[model samples]
Target: MDTVEVVCSKLVEDADKWRAAADGMSKAADAAGGLAMGAEQFGKIADERGVVSAYAPLQQTFTTLASGAATEFAKIADTLTLVAETYLREDQAGEHAMRRLEDRL
Candidate 1:
């Protein structure tokens, strides 16, 4: 796969990992009313990385498009990346918040 596709695939993979981590965190947080002592906070890194992985090139794509340097496929990729990034950032922020809570607990 091309670099852009490869990056997106990795981001998607990382997003899945983050989603799993978020799921586990939700369960733990629900059970403990937050995180228990010694519990590791997870997902934030993956989520954030996933966002960057997925969107960095997307922004690039748009920039290229606006500058008339992008082809149709690149525009499509950029659009997809923008949409994907939206979700990824939300998840990342949630995970980050969880991490902060864990740290405080």
Candidate 2:
């Protein structure tokens, strides 16, 4: 059906957008981790209380959290792409079967 085709097209488009967003999220996470480490180094140079040592755990925690978030984002993007492709394939197959039946009639 034309409606099914249209819906599938939209789904594929949305999936592509999601994939792009996931990539952006990963880049952001990487940048954040780099910035946090840089800040830790800077703190060590400027502080007497061994701030870097004290803050190392917090920085590591943030990096880990960001990494986890990026991983989940990638997984979500993959799922969206797979679901869109599957729906489009099924819709095309049904249309093809209908055409064959129509020819027999």
* Runs of candidate 1 exceeding 4 Å displacement: 34-105
Candidate 1 lDDT over residue span 1-105, tens digit each: 454445666666655555555555444435443322221232456545565455546555544443342233344445555666766677679889999999999
> Candidate 2 versus the native: TM-score?
0.71
lDDT of 1: 0.53
lDDT of 2 by residue, 1-105 (tens): 468667767777776777777777677768767765434466646556666565667767777777777777777777777887788789889999999999999
Model 1 C-alpha RMSD to native: 27.3
Please give the RMSD to the true structure for each candidate, in Å. Answer: 27.3, 3.2
lDDT for predicted candidate 2 compared with the true structure:
0.73
Q: Clashes in model 1: which pairs? A: none
